[model samples]
Target: MEYFALTNAWLIPLMPAIAFVLIGLFFKRWSALSACIAVFASAVSFILAIFAAIAVIGSGISVDAPFVGHVIWAEAADLHFEMGMLIDPLSVMMLFVVSLVSLLVQIYSIGYMRGDKSFGRFFAYISLFSASMLGLNISANFLQMYIFWELVGLCSYLLIGFYYQRIAAREAAKKAFITTRIGDFGLLIGILLLQTVFGTVDFLELRQLLPSYIASYGTGTLTIIGILLFIGPIGKSGQFPLHVWLPDAMEGPAPVSALIHAATMVVAGVYLVARAYFLFASVPALLEFIAWLGAFTAFFGASIAISQREIKRILAYSTISQLGYMMLALGVGSLTASLFHLFTHAFFKALLFLCAGAVMHAMNDEADIFKMGGLRKKIPIVFITMTIGVLAISGVPPFAGFFSKDEILSAALSVNTPIYIIAVITAFMTAFYMARLLFVVFFGEKTNMRLHHISCFMQIPLVLLAVLSLVSGLGGYIYDFGYWIRFGAPQPEHMDISIAVLSAVLPLLAFILAWNIYVRKKWSADCIAARMGVLYTISFHKYYIDEFYAVLCRFFIDGIGRVMYFIDIYIIGGIINVISGLVLFSSTLLGKIQTGQTQRYAAAFLCGVIILLLCGILYFNKISGITAGGGVL
Candidate 1:
């Protein structure tokens, strides 16, 4: 029975990979069945993950499967790589969240992706992504974890560019892969350095080894390594400076937006930081830097999300901002709170994305909030689910997001007062923008260019995710799961009633303001832009961050790549050709002497032997430094 538990964890991830492989290999024959199989496999995996999480919680980390199955993956001096499963409280929770959201997204995709030619490919990629993420969660060591991490990134790239024919989608995918690759490079170096310093890569062993290792390296080396490792979180988590790819990622399908952008791929960074908490704790300066980076990202992302008219773009920025909150939690040394926020954010964010998908489906794939209005009545389930998600994300009471978000804010406050203040402002901005999006899209008079209806499959996931958004937080309180496990027990941590009230009040106020401006007063954003002038220009242009990145990339990566390409084609190739020609000429000269004449060959051999004997005698006699004649003779 215990073995069944171990087998189930591996099998849950394996089934999806199997489905993806089969669908990809036999696309023509298995295209139609792939969607159903993908959905079924994800659902089964989600159920298994839930059961596993419960069983792990019940048993309370009694069985640590250090390596359920281990195989030598690589070997070098002082470095050995093995692959296996590592089931801990953290991984169990992540597995459940990822699987659950994946299942719902896949189910929704059935209706949303219908009639699309690449439907099978879409589901296949989703299944592959789910399996990879689960594998990453349960990986036993850094090497295996890196493998799966890269796999998930690959899947994200594929899904983000699912519409490969679209230029914007292709560009976005390229940007995402390239940007994350830079982070991955840093992570790879950090892992190698850890392995070089500590002789073992196992998580438990490394946790024990790192303290002594840090003592030896001193503070400076530790901080450098910590900061280097933190680069990975910046890229994957959409932190400041490396966050340009996430917004463009909205070019993918809406279901993809729900799964990769909202639920799974983006959260992997926070998980990595939490996984390496022991190492991070040693470097307080690094942690503070991370905290400030997260704070700035949270504030910046929310500000950009506020002015976006495209529905998916708004959600994209929201995901970035929410990810910043999670990073902030980790930065504040509140790993449990960060993980809690991740759990709650997954549900509501997925719900919001799915509801947005439903709206897009209903409006004939229209995603502009400016063009959509009065959709609340047309898509009642979507409206209800979206409202739940919006409120939850806004940190309204009793919702999943409120508890986790409040915990993060409290943790930030405990760490630094200024960061806490910044976080609250970000929270207020989050509430305002979300409410603005909700009002402009769901309220007002009908302005849709086309009309359609959402299918039951799409609506069902929306409703289910909405329920999760509303109720998931209670799990931490009732079952003693999630953050409660780390906190030991749920105790009020000096709640600031004024800050909480301000956080809660601002969203409603934003909603009311948006209603007056966009709904009741019928003021268009463009009209406001005309009145505000430069403020509108800055908001509309997203403060020129994208343009800045473009200029930087063009001057560095593209320019350097072009020079390298030219060198490779002309100078390097010419050198190789010249070397090849000389080798050929030498070969030809040597071959001419290998004629089938025994007399000629014998003459040449005798001459060569004479020359060798003469040279050896001369060198021994003339170049000798010792008195060989007196000592040996």
Candidate 2:
């Protein structure tokens, strides 16, 4: 098992990849077969991923040295490009999470997407998505990682626009694609710079040589590279400024959302930062910036979620906020904490999104929480599962979120108080908004609509995810997950009891406050919003960030596109048109002269000769007249 796990890590990604091709090429005509292929392929991949994790544990894979396998793919002059796999604690963790979540989501999709005309195609796209992310997990070098990264991005565009008939889906796909490319461009440059300086982009090589490179080149150049690299994550992970596309990505199917928000696409960004911690660690100032920026994003996302109406959109904002916390963990120099949260987040978040799907399924696709109430009895399984997800995400005790979230706060508190303060505030806001969502949607007056059935296929993944969400936090104690995925030498492992208690208490208090306002009606939610008018309004509108980008696009992106279009249609085109017109005129005159007869050609040649003879006679007369005036002439 260990040997197979180590040697056949490539097969982990290959399973879903083969499924993708099969479904797209052959199985697409049969929706049931396509769904089965996708789910079975994902299940196999998940099984292999579990074995990979076991191999990591049994073999004692460490951070400093990871298993590397490679083969040269291209040669240019003195350079060689290789494709390979790198398996270690980090990759294995990501592999397990990516596969598990993808498998569950695919299974849940079987029910949620039933009877849709494009059902087979949806499975195909997500299969490709899973393949891309799994490939990204085991990438051996920067080149390989970036290739899979862009592939993941492409799959996102395809899946997000799966409902191509809808304007929202189409626009959202384009927005996500274009926005992330802005960061990807920077990342490309950074990778190129690394290759130029170090002569290779291999992870193991870089790890071995970074210390010497830092000493030789100074921190400034490394800092620039670090920032450029982080730009990719910032855009990918739904961090501020470039974060607008994340919430809008909810325009995709619910299963796609679960896959992306939970384990695959958005996590790619956080994973990248964690993967390349050595570079960031070398630059303290930049590291501090990351911590602060992450804290801000956490706050930003939570603030927006508070006033969101759509259940999926609320969860979307929650994804953003949670991603921010992962970034915060990365920034605070705890790779373990960051990845710990990442692991736990995959289970609970996927559960939450799937529950949202079940609820929407019941409500005939109405997503507004205001339109739903007293649904706990109607869909007991969904309500129960959703409640577990909420508790886990809200950082309540003994759930997945609490343990990981505590580590993030403790890490922050030990380093920077200001960021920690911001983190603590964000935690309360996260708890409040998530609790607000739960209470509002499941309580209040019951809403009536045409009910859609929730199938067994859908219920199973939700229940399993709820179980994981309940117990995944305990991995911190049972398995000591932190000790294995640590960046370097393990830090003294001790929980800050005070920090843990505070993080736990704050969330409970926030939950209580939400219950008061939304459940008991003891506090006026509307009155509070009215008092905080602009603040509430701003957050409700996602801080007008999307609108801000729209203005910039109109004045900048669209403006440039317009100019380019003008040049293509008029300036360059006019020159060609003028030349064509001149040729046409010449051809018309030539057509008149060059008749298809020897007589016409002979006549034209004779006329040209007679005109030349007349010019010669006139010139001779003019010369004779001048010579008559002077004998020397």
Candidate 3:
């Protein structure tokens, strides 16, 4: 039964992979057909994912021993490598989350991208993204995961730069690619170190052997490896310093934003760390780093989010901040809290981005929140759905975000008081900024433009996602998310009463304050901004991070590029030129010596032979005790 189920599960990622090739190559000119193929493929994968989840759950394979589908991939010099599909609770949960969100996004794009020129291409990229993400989720080994990891990054590059004509989109895609690569480099090094120290990269095997290896190698070695491994998640999850690329990623289409933030790309980091919880668990110091980094990032991203006016940019920062919460949960030793938040976040964040897309579609790509007003009546469904999404994200009760986020806060409070404080503050800022977005975009004065009707294609997905946002939290209470993918780690302690109370109160207070400021207009946001002038200025400019990067890029990358260019043009070029000149000179001299006469060639050959014979006689005479002048003188 497990074998049959694993075989079917293999088709989960394969279906979308086939769709990507078929649509991208054959049906590209047939936009409608291409979209149909893509959506059908994704829907099939989603169904298969559902079945896989059921199978994995019913099989009752312990986290220590996942139901792995394996085939020998390589054998070299006494080493064996196998390709594997890991169907444990964690992968199964991620499979459902990814496939569901991917299918809905594909469905939503039908309406959001109707009549676009590169519609076929868009579907192709989207399908490819889904396939890559699914592959990453079920990977049985670190190497396999890394391979799929890069595939998703490639898909992100293609999707983010879907509008190839737009310079901003192209640059954003490039930035996202390059920034993530920094972390990828670290991950690669870590993987190599693991493979060197241990012959296998299998997750299960590694977890079993890691403690022994650490005992043999000392904790310092494990700390180094853990830190290296964490780098990949940091960049992918948009943690702190590497987070700059995420906001710029909004330059892509809004659906892409939903896919990257909600289903696939950014969440990969959190999923990865959770997948390898054993490594961090062994290295206590590294875990503290993860916790502190996550806390700081949560606060950092939320701080920046509050000052942004662009709807997607606000959501982008919000994503970075939320990802921080996930990492913080992991750092606090609660995989359940982290995964729970990841699941709930997927639904609400997707809803939020899709809702934003609907508004952008109506407004002819208008993204500025301050410019939008009185849209509640015009797009009432979006208003309602987006409101729910905002509430969920702000941790309002009964919404998905509240359950997961509260759990994370509780975990933090139990492990580290500082992170707990940071998380609570971030939650406050999250609500304040989200409320600001809602009130400004859906309420207040109306913008001067004819409203576009929400298409059924778009509306269906939003409605579905909103429903999920409201109900997905039930998983935390009912399913014991921590136990589901405990991966040998102990479950987080129950939520602390004080922390839960604070969590309930913070978002509410922030929401009321936002309402008073933005909707009621009783207090000016600008006046408050002026009161907190320096901080506002800094946050508004994203702490000048982009500027700092620009300067570094200009002076450092460009400088190094210039040096390489000079070497290429002068030093290497000069060597090549000298070689060419020597060849040219010799060729010219040989050309002059060439005579189109057999007799001349024969005479030259004879003369050369006579000279050689004369030299030979002189050498013989000298060797026989004869002088060069006359054999003996």
Candidate 4:
């Protein structure tokens, strides 16, 4: 307890960073030991994270900046970012979730990536990712958070492209990085503007400073900033118009997908919005827009997920859809609900992804659900774990996802009927698609290309996560911070059991519908295509969102890059060449005069001195009127 009292939360993240450096720097030399070190370091950090969370929760909102430590990062504007940690409830929850999932994934990777050539490097990157995410979670100020935000993005890029030998993996990683960077730029500007307006980036300080001006911005400036800040979440959380990178991110290893996409990186956007909920709450219109955006993304992502053939891509789009629910919770001023969903989601989604990894490991990395069938008998542990994950994600009764998803849906209904409708429809689609995936993969005839056995290590984590997915809801954690903590009064009433039952039943209906089409009736692609025509085409193509992005990228980013390349080649290079020619000519002329003779150098020096003296004398005489006037001189 004393150590917890004095220890900086920064130490939790620092340990992983140290591990990353040591493992990565000598990965090739250390090989097997490097991974062990990475895993050990992560395990330690995970333990520290739990201690930090306990300390934070026990102490409960100390505002004295207890662990303040600093170095001069910048001086001109008096910006001094201290290397410290803030241990509020929000930060504590994020620390626990991130550390727990990251530790499990790292351990699971030991089995999944057992014989890979880059195993050491893989663990190193995983450690770096854990450190960055934990740092981002506990950051005391926006600048520090932003730095770690970009660091997590960097780790995501590296991990997503870990199989650099594969072109698809590399391309997917680049797309993920570049797309998210666009939103990050918006986030950076919003943070700078906040600092300009509030004079500080510290969260507690800004929270206190913002209430007075809640009415001053007249909704215009606040809306712009709020929306700009929301852009970061849109990109990071895989919302509409910026969600293209996430599905393709399935090209990475399954373990990477489990940690980054399902449990951590993708959730950063939701965390950002929830973290700055006060700013958004001040701009009602912006919050409303966020609600609509989340609703749209949920419907859009779920619809696309319905048709995905790849097992991981289905989960990837499922993540996008589920993240939309969290965004909806945030947009509707249900920050605690969003965080609650985020917490429960970490367990279930991670369980789903890890189970997927187990299946992939058994099938020699085959991810096509169409090619996989009746795997339950072969991989019973995976089947059971995945069933729990699917049930949880489907919002079945008593499961973790049931409570969180129902809470968000209830909140959305209370906010607006339209959003509730959209959310409910998305839930139905989620169940349908997820069940469709499960039935086809585990309950059908055997169609697998090859099969192998999964290790006990991989199965254990999957089983543990599955249990969490089922029972985390029973912990009775409050989903409304204001109501639970007495920070602010609760607003409107939530929907009752009738609404919850209706919403829950919609998914079962969808499951039956999908079952009729894809399983029981055995509808072929051509038959569905013939029946649905353009509707089928649109769903299959993800409503042409990716194509729209392709056009936009071709006309804007690629076009601008080409223009800049031309300018660099023609105009800038021409000027450089001209300067180079003049320099070369002068060098040629001076080369002849420098014959390695000290006498020649002395003569040139004396000549230059005489010329300077003459010029000085003439200027003094001309300007100072000091021909013979000593007083003026």
Candidate 5:
């Protein structure tokens, strides 16, 4: 049975991959069939993932010894690279989360995307993304992981801009792809450096070899590698600066947003760091850097989210902020807490996005929360499900997010008080914005706009996700998530009860505060905005980060590009034109000499004869002098 499970484990990725090809090629005109194909493939993969997890658990394989199935991908110049599956607890857990969420998202997209011209195309992209994410999860080595990592990026670019005809979608896709590439370049360099120093990129091999490399070469090499490796996650997970692409990514369909933010792309970065926790552990400085960066990003993202009027954009920033929490957890040496938060966040975030999709669908594609009021009476299912999601993400009790996010805050409090403070403030903002979103979108005077009938396809996924959001937190108490996560690594420190209580209470207080402002309208938001003019402007404009990037891009495109154009057109082209002109002039002179006239030919011949006679006379004089000198000698 173990052997069979290992052999078929490859099917987890292959199923969706094959589905992607079929849906793209054969089902171009058949939306229903395409959805079935994609969803079925994902469902099968999820079942297989569950079986694989059970097998791993039943086998009782310790963390030091995971079940690794290998296939030689390449071998050259004494380097052997393998592509395989690492069926450890972590990979198995991620496999389930990614596949489950992907399956749900695909099912939700069915109703959300009905009658859309590119429905089949959307399914194809989703399936392809799922396959890439699964591949990343099960990767046995860094080389294999990087290959799938790039594939995931490509999938995101495709999905985020699913509405390719829209200029905003195209621009957002380009921004997402280009922004992430900066970090990818750094990650690639880091991978090559690791290969140079350690001569291997396999996770298990690195576990054995990194210490030796560090001892022989000192900590500097690991420091460089750690930072480089982190760049990839920073880009992938939407960490600070690199995080600018995520909110714009809302241009895609809501399901695609769910996929990117909740299940696949954004979480990949956190997973990447967790997967390579050993390297960061070796470099305390790098770990600290990761921790502080995550804390700052959490605060930064939350601040921006509070000011966002667009429903999906608010969720986008929320994902960024939650991702920062994961990163912060990792930075503070709590891999389990990071992964735990990652798992729970996936469900609630997906629920939130899907709920947004339903609302948008009913409201004739309206996305602004203020424009959408009294939706609670129109779409009660969405209202209920979305409320669950709101409560979960806000860290309210019994929801999945409460347990996971609390763990991260607890981890921060134990290690760094300043980060803990930042995290707590961010948590408060998270609740405030979500509370504002819920009240503004669902509770006000009804707009008399025509509404679409809620479809079963979309409602089903929301219901399923809502249940998960409520119960997924139970994973914390059912079994020790921290223990399962840190099975192979150093044990993580326990969080203080005081820290947990603070983490849980802050968000609740923020919710009450948000309720007072947006729900009750006790104090006008506009009045508050006027009072805090500069601060509100900064938050609303997202700290001018997007503007800064625009200016930087404009400089490169206009300023430097103009210089290059000038060089090509005038300097290089002018030199070539000058040579061509000289050649043409000399040819014209030669043409004049070769005029088709007997008199001209005769003059030319006579000139040539005179020149030849002069050369002969000088040659004869020189020869005669040598001959005379030799004869006298």
Candidate 6:
């Protein structure tokens, strides 16, 4: 089983990779076949992942003694690099999540994306997306992981901009790509620093050597490295100040959103931090900073989500908020809680996004929640499933989100009081926004929008994910999630009665508030907005964060661009002109001297000879003194 885990695990990524190539090559004309190939690849990967996970579990592999195998990829003087596979508790868990979700997304896409012009290409891109993340999850070293990381970004770029015909889609893809690259730059610096100082990027080897880096270089070095590494997550996970691209990412198809937000691109950041928890844990100050940053991002995202009218955009901001929640757990030094949230969030978020996709399908991609009304009886399944998703995300009792979100809150309160307060506030805002979205979209005044039939392909994944959302967190708790998916030390059973009650009660209160405002019209939303004034306006405009970024771009990026342009057109160009003028002027004088005649050349030579002879006779003889010797002359 161990050997099978090692040898056969590579197939998990390879299958989807091959599907990408095959669909791009031979299946372009057949959309159905293309989807079939992609889904089959992902299904095989899922099955293989299950078997591999079983092997790891049955073999009793622990974190400290994770099953790892490597073949030397390259060698140089005093250095060795290896192509490696690591089967640890974390990787195995990610394997199951990624493959399962990827498979379902592809299946869902068959119906959602049917009859689209670029359907084959869409499947191919998503296939590569899955393959890249699968590869990233099992990577044994930072080098391999980084390679897959960039691939994941590339897939997101392609998938997010799937409809290249739309200006918004194209720009969103570019924005998502470039924004993440900024964070990736910092992550690359951290990796290089680790390699330069420790001479290795292998996770296990680095784990053994990090203490020496501290002993020799002090905690300051780890602080820099940890922060640098975390910058990548901040960008990937849509944390504040770098989070403007996420809501815009709704330009793509619904399945793309589900795939990217729930299981792939965004999750990469939190997963990286969890995978490299040792570096962060070694630096207490960095961890604290991370916790605070996460707290603010959560608040920021949820605040924006409350005001968003677009179905997918609201979900997009919610994803950012949930990612912030995960990062908060990590920042608070509870990897188990963070990962547990990650696990549960995967299902519910995907379910939510897929349900939104269903609504879009039924309404011809109409995004405004205000335009959607009386959908409860129109699409009963989506309404019910989306309600479950909303409740799960709101941390309502017995839902997957309640268990995992409670754990994160518990983790935060035990560590920092201020952070805990921010987190609680964020949680309330989360519930309010989600409930508001529900009431506004499904139960508001009926609109004139036409509805289409949602196919079984889309509904199946929603049902499955909704089930996961309902029970995954409880299952994680029952199975002792902390025992395997943890860092520093094994986590003990923990649930503060007060915190749990707050977690449960606050969301319900927010739900009731949303009900009164949007459902029963007991409270006036516009009046509340009028009362809040600037605060409401700021949130409605997404806190003007994107505008702020645009301002910064105008001031700095565009400023630098103008400088470079001036140099190119004037400074550098003027110098070149000056040199050219000099060369031309000199050539013109020489051209005049040439005259194109032998007689003129002879006359000039004679004049030059006479002048030299006179100078020689006068100056040369005087300098020679007594004798005007020919030799002296």
Reference-based TM-score of each model: 0.87, 0.93, 0.94, 0.86, 0.94, 0.95
Error of 4 at 401 (Å): 0.8
Model 4 error, position 11 (Å): 2.3
Q: Write candidate 6's Cα lDDT for 163-270 as tens digits.
A: 888898999999999999999999999999989877888999989988877888789777888888888988998988788878888888999999889999999999
Q: For candidate 2, write residues 1-633 as lDDT tens digits.
A: 787888999999999999999999998989999999999999999999898889888987777667879999899999899999899989998999899999999999999999999998999999999999999999888999999999999999999999999999999999999999999998999999999988888888888899997878788988899999999999899998888889889899888889989999999999998888888988988888888888889988888998999999999989888998898888888888899999999999999999998898899888999888988888899999999999999989889899889889989888889888998999999899889888988886787766788999999999999999999987664678777888888654467899989978998999999999999999899999999999989988888888887798789989999999999989999999999999999999978866689997898899999999999999999899889877865
Specify the poorest-scoring 10-residue window by lDDT in model 3. 624-633
Instruction: List residue ranges in candidate 5 displaced over 4 A.
Output: 487-495, 579-617, 626-631
Tell me the spans in candidate 6 whose CA falls farther than 4 Å from its real position: 76-80, 591-620, 626-633
Please report, in order, the local distance difference test score of every candidate based on alpha carbons.
0.82, 0.90, 0.90, 0.81, 0.90, 0.90
Full ranking by TM-score: 6, 3, 5, 2, 1, 4
For candidate 1, the lDDT comes to 0.82
Candidate 3: segments with Cα more than 4 A from true spot: 1-3, 76-79, 489-493, 609-633
For model 1, how does the per-residue alpha-carbon lDDT over 501-619 read when each residue is reduced to its tens digit? 76668667767767778877766666876998887678678889889888977999899999999999899998999999999999999999989999999999999999999999988
TM-score of 1: 0.87
Error of 4 at 211 (Å): 2.4
- List per-candidate RMSD values in Å: 5.5, 2.9, 2.6, 6.2, 2.8, 2.7
Model 4 score (lDDT): 0.81
